[model samples]
Target: MPSGPSFLKKFTSLILSFGPGIFAIGYTIGTGSVTSMIVAGSTHGMQLLWVLLLSCLFSGILIYVYGNYTLLTGETALFAFKRHLKWGRVMAILIIIGIAIGQWNSLMGIMGISSNIIYEIFAIYFPGISSFKYEAVITIALVLTAVFYALLLVGRYTFFEKILVVFVTIMGVSFLISLFMVYPLPEDVIKGLVPSIPQVKGGRMLVAAFVGTTMAAATFLSRPLFVKGKGWTINNLKEQKKDAIVAAILVFVISGAIMAVATGALFYEGKPVTQVLDMVNTLEPVAGKFALTLFFFGTLSAGLSSIFPILLIVPILIADYQSGQLDTNSKQFKRITAFACLFALIVPIFGSNPVEMQILSQIFNVFVLPLVILGILLLINKKSIVQVHKTHFLLNIGLGLALLFACIISYNGVKALIDYF
Candidate 1:
């Protein structure tokens, strides 16, 4: 066997190649996702695991499909939609509007929840901070937004990717530690693989939400841009596939860890998770201070990791709308990031319901998913564009299945939203 240094070098090289995928994990598992997975676990045990599994499965396929398109053609998703297909302009505009709205709304909840987490952390060590909840959260939100925007101005795509890798690593390691500390039964987790939903009143909606959160339009749509930003091309096809696989697996593992922790710590005890502190306190009774702190760290990492990408979404998409070249130094990029930071302030300032914002964001996300898939379906299959690199029959079948899944989830998500209101 090679010496320790050589093995370490190979491992480091492998991890570095997955920059875009790691970026996806950080982007996908924001505070909203944490709450959803925890609530799913606490309420239904591992019964909803099927939803997460299938979502991640299709998520990988779509990532590969979308990234493959860019690798083959050297064009971003939105530009291809607007430039190539019939009625392409309308479709591109609609996607832009849809994803932008969903993402900004999600940003509000992330900033709000993340701010509350910071406040909660303070409150734990110093009880006096609890009385000034609004003031505390607001100040933290301001500082976080400012720090993130500063980092935005100072760095380019690789810089952002490197930062997310840190957060993702922290998040994954924290959650894995907490999971090993307290775990659900293997039989329960095994049962989740069989695919069934809880028969509760809003069970269908929760399942739809599981899909919405995991199989995000943003995750797939943005992959091409990230891949191109990594300076990858068709020659990097093997690496791209490996990256997508790693990312999808990470999503499943991290999300599954959250679910398992909730199941072991909260489900058996019948504890509720309506707030950030709920899960924290639940873990406290099960595994003491260390596990609780780890959970908090995981959550903070998830939130901070998400904030960077959420701020970049508008600028990135607008850049993709023109083509795939993202100039962080451009005035347009600066103005958009500044604008998104303002939106992030709303929830912390006025105090909106995080759960409500989360639900609404998923509704918008699920509704746009079908269109997102169909557009790519057209482009990936076009012989004029993809040449000999056209999608295979199996991949087209997978896309068809993804489209059908998207439509189903959209219907359930809308129904859930109506019921919620």
Candidate 2:
């Protein structure tokens, strides 16, 4: 029995403590993840599930390490890179360019897929709408983009966190329910958890894409920003670690559920899924209309959740490079964010194949992983920057292995991109 003011204070503290991690989950489990997981399961069944698990596992480690670095140094990733090591500025520039291109491609795909799904839903419910017009689709995409930017423009970090929590809840619960409707076999899931790559053609490329997208370089780079925004420090390291673990677990569970639903509903069927709409059509017969609708909205929410962060990432990167504060109220910040959000419109307005663009963005994402990993490894181990929080030998070893894995994936990603072009 505490006083009202005291109880409210406690509650606010609790919410703030978990806010960064929840934001991470919201940012991580977006359209790219939903698309990747569903495609993997639909095309290859649960054979690649281990890749999701391992990617999340590695992502969790790297995320924690990066957060820890920021807590100890009071510096964001780009600043740390700039201040600590030689060639850091060049690496930062490369990272910014890579992430900008990848995010631009993803922004187009997200808006395109979300608008398409909405248009289809409208056509289904409203018989008067005879055809799915590109005009309507583009209009919806523009509206969605405007709404996302408006929210970011007005909202602070707390508000953004609350919105993400709502989105993550809606998307997570909907996907989980849909998964239950067509529950995958436990034995198949168990087999999927075992560490083994499929022998199928393009399996290596698929694995690389999965790893690249899940353990994305942007996610790691963004971690420090979130941590610093939350005002976390060495004293809050334990809480930061807990937050990272929770975010990682959420990524695994939500991603696994998406794959499970796809595996149970689409695998072994002769049908091929080329887009999100194809998923809905295939799932309608197997999981019924209710589940299909849930999945559709769930996917839409995922797309929207992802857009929020993509809008802010460029601004954050710029802020970090300039050694400036992450003040949403600043004119420069708003301008950069608005431009990034609006720039996505070009693809939907002009691109012929949104799905191909999305896939290409994911491949581009793979090329950046090794660079980010190497940067973090070099910075974190340096006693000059990290101080007493210098990475322990075991953690360094783990990161070293991750760097090696990222390098291999980068090679495969490059080869895949060449093949695609």
Candidate 3:
């Protein structure tokens, strides 16, 4: 470690250039994703690592494709859809509505989980705050909502990205520490790469949630917006691809670490994670109190990072729908984000199980995946619009595989929901 200011300087330099992808990771790998990974890892050990593997793979491809579109055509994803394809206006509207609903549902989970984690941390330290559980949780969630809303009102796009960089760095370090302290067996991890679904209840939904949260439609759709905000062009294609790769790799490593930690510390003991408290305890014995504190901080950082972006997503998507230019200081942006932050309070205040709510919210994103992937597939292949920059054969094949994967998972998501009901 470099001393004092030099260490801070190098760290800031390291992450500043990785803006867009870091923002995406900041949004995707949050409390919802963490909770889902913990539940799956605790219940089924490393069996579902394949789901995480493929999700990160496809996530990189989709992010590259979406970012590439803005690079080539200088158009955001929704605007490209509306401008090129027929019935695209309606399609864009549905996307706006669908993604908005799913992301809002996600906000509830993020807020609830973060608040509850704070509650857990308090209960662990003081041991008496257990009686004020709901009161403490609601207060934390409300304060967080207000703080994020205030940040939205005052800060620009780059400001939000900078803040997320801090969150990502902290969570990354925290989880890595926990993983090192309580890593799973090499044989079990290797077996996880072979791909076998669990026959137990909620297994299918966990699969869908893993895919949905990692390979999120919101991630791809919003890539163009973030790319444009970064002010990249065709000249920056390589840089954009590198950023996407970084995002995908971080998603995999951080998420996998959390899962592996759970497998090592919880699964062997025959414990199942149904709540945030279960997650906190997953690091017990081997890692002890300090590790548990770090883990909760990671969860808390993940939640805050996600909540900020989730609050802004509605305005960002709507901005793309109306015009590619995002006026962050505009009334539409402030009003939409304000309402979203307010809406996020409901879950923490009255919700029973944030973990279940989070997994359900993540699974919901899968239902929108097929259409999202198909729309991009059609757009990238359209010669009239793409001209010389048309998608190549290999990428097209990858997109095709992605489409198939999306459809299969979408079906699973639906069936799982039906069974759940």
Candidate 4:
């Protein structure tokens, strides 16, 4: 073992090497994290806080499992699926479709919510700036879209990873600062740690919704793809572990802080938070209107930063299903990116209910959760790839539990949708 100073020097370099997973965590903690946590804080007032805690633990385990496999095998999860079990290719395709639907809903919803937040910020700041609201949103979106394409053109993983890390750090600090300013009660916060149901009639559904949002199907599917993009290998095992742990902790902090802020401002006041804008507005009385503006900017950054990688992941996933691996330079990758962007542009134009759309898309996305997880687990644990590093029995059992929980959620989700229809 190295001495303390030497270890610190090496550790710093290892941390720098672990970028893609950090960005993948950013993608996971975007709209889903914001919307669901906002809903939980307003509706249940931290009573369902255990959902985030439990989901974070489970999500960490899943990310570690997926990231470890990619690091060991040097192949993305989709390719592993095709190579190990040819018949399981359909499940891989389903994972991509599920991811595409989820990403489509999230990308559009984030844009809409962030746009609303910006509009509110201008109104609060300038107070008379009515005309620029729409233009401002369009301008911001175009700027972000252009930056995304520019990064894609460069085609270097390091550049994309650095941009994502910078954005993630900024967004994370902004929210943490907001939470500190709010100064929530420690006793009530502690009470949130207990796993109790809320008092409302529809509280259980909200609890499940909270769980669904945190343990998002798309977030799960995207982990391996993101790891592959980083070009990790067996030589980087230490780096992979560090990256997974850091990424998971970062996600938990940002998501949990958002919940804390919402609960601090709205929960005790008996206010409702049905939309992201509502959460932003609720912050004004407690943290001042300018704080709300800051929150909006932070939220906007969080949402906008995630759109590119999510788009990038989809086409690569689709391409991997057709071929055993993804060629970033291939026509399929470009076409899929275009298709994803088209969906992003069109999804919100229909003017559907954002919450309802989130619920529907998540429901459809959850259907393939079992298949996707199973295939990934199987491929990763295979002798050819894993060799002596096969998955442990305990890990397999835990994965089984995750799959079971996902299936139960999917069943309830489908039943709810069917009854509604």
lDDT of 2 by residue, 114-210 (tens): 8777878887888676564677778888898889888987748778878877788789889999987986788899899787766765566677768
* Winning candidate number (lDDT): 3
**What is the C-alpha local distance difference test score of each model?**
0.84, 0.81, 0.87, 0.67
Worst 10 residues of 1 by lDDT: 354-363
Tell me the spans in candidate 2 whose CA falls farther than 4 Å from its real position.
1-17, 195-202
Error of 3 at 173 (Å): 0.9
Candidate 4, lDDT over the whole model? 0.67
Q: What overall lDDT, based on C-alpha atoms, would model 3 receive against the true structure?
A: 0.87
What would the C-alpha RMSD of candidate 3 be, to one decimal place?
A: 1.6
Q: Candidate 4, which segments miss by more than 4 Å at Cα? A: 1-17, 125-128, 131-143, 196-205, 324-326, 347-363, 419-421
lDDT at residue 301 of model 2 (Cα atoms): 89
lDDT of 3 by residue, 333-357 (tens): 9899988988898898786688999
- Give the clashing residue pairs of candidate 3, or none: none
Candidate 4 residues 169-206, lDDT tens each? 66777788888776457777788888787665445455
TM-score of 3: 0.97
Model 1, residue pairs in steric clash: none
The collision pairs in model 4 are: none
Colliding pairs, model 2: none
* Candidate 3 segments exceeding 4 Å error: 1-8
Which candidate leads in TM-score? 3
Clashes of 2: 0
Is 1 or 4 the stronger prediction by lDDT?
A: 1
lDDT at residue 257 of model 4 (Cα atoms): 86
Model 4 sits at a Cα RMSD from the real structure of: 4.3
